[model samples]
Target: MRKYIITGLLVWLPLAITIWVLLWVLGIIDGVFVWLLSAVQAVLPDSARASIRELHNIPGLGVLVLVAALMLTGMFVANMFGQWWFRQWDRLLFKIPIVKSIYSSVKQVSDTLFSSSGNAFREAVLVPYPHPQSWTIAFVTGKPAGEVGDQLATLSGAASEEHVSLYVPTTPNPTSGFFLMMPRSQLRPLAMSVDEALKYIISMGVVAPASDALSAHPAKQPAAAESARN
Candidate 1:
């Protein structure tokens, strides 16, 4: 009976967690819609507020509204008129005091990570962190560019050696971690995708790539060692 119960739990645990998370997210979205309705109600006269308040009780309305809003916003922002308005709106936001500081920082990071032309988190690799003896999993965000790369090259003293930009995420909370740079020669690349690396990091090594998996650039290690010797 105990063995059967354990097996049943193993099957149901993931489903339970998945449902719980979805409900949590739905609650948050629904609350936001409720708050928006309350705000709208506050501005309108008492006689006009009932209709808006009535819609707030509808189930799944917030998710639909949020999805529609996102789609419409995306469609709107795809054109020249919207582009001009967006730039103006961006400028307006930057003019605000405390809001600008928070908004600008988040905007820059989001643009870097989500932009089509950017290479942030494109590849995963093992990085020698703190010491050469210890290594950590990291994402290859992008190399230092233009002036930063030039300065690093000048400071590194190894004129021929190249460097890579990496983001080493902490276990369980991958969002908060270190941004570091390492020599391209020392990096041991992985065949896993960025998503796989994130899962592994967040799981604190419990979740890992398949045993038979190969490195993305396994041959580069020997070549790099050869170049180091030369």
Candidate 2:
């Protein structure tokens, strides 16, 4: 009985937490839809209520309807008319003082992260951080570009430096992390897969293994040294 209990916990613990988190998010979104539907019902006329009221008939279905509506709206904005309208809308948004700063910052990050051509989160790399010889797992967020690249060249003393932005995520919570920029030569590419590296970090060093090949490998000696200068 004791052996079986340990096995059961090992099997079900991850699944239970995963399901619990997902359901919690879904419940919150569902509540938002219910509130919106209620508001619509109050302002809507008797005849017009038929359309929105149909949404309330299906249990936990209003959120699905809202999601579909949002997708369709996005598709419409992706068209030609949407392009012109979006620019006008953005111009208006920038006129607002406090809102403009927050909106613009978020927009820039979203564009960089979601752009098809961007190189964010492409690889797992090892970097010396906090101290020399101390290593940490980091994701290559992107290569510095534009004015940022120009500035890095002066700071790093390389006219054409390879500066990469990395996200050094903390343990257990990968969503929040430290952002850093370092020369590419300083970053050592890790042989481990990203998923394995993430698991190692989330476990807070309790679940990592020594890399024999990586630790043992050394630079090859020059072949000319063997032949001698004679």
TM-score of decoy 2 = 0.79
All candidates: TM-score: 0.86, 0.79
Model 2 lDDT per residue over 70-109, tens place: 9988898899998889899999999999999999999998
lDDT of every predicted structure (CA atoms): 0.86, 0.80
Would you list the clashing residue pairs of candidate 1?
none
Q: Candidate 1 — which residues are off by over 4 angstroms?
A: 45-48, 211-230
Report the Cα lDDT for residue 56, model 1: 83
Global fold similarity of model 1 (TM-score): 0.86
User: Compared with the true structure, what per-residue lDDT tens digits does model 1 show for residues 7-106?
Assistant: 9998999899999999999999999999999999999998989888899889889999999999999999999999999999999999999999999999
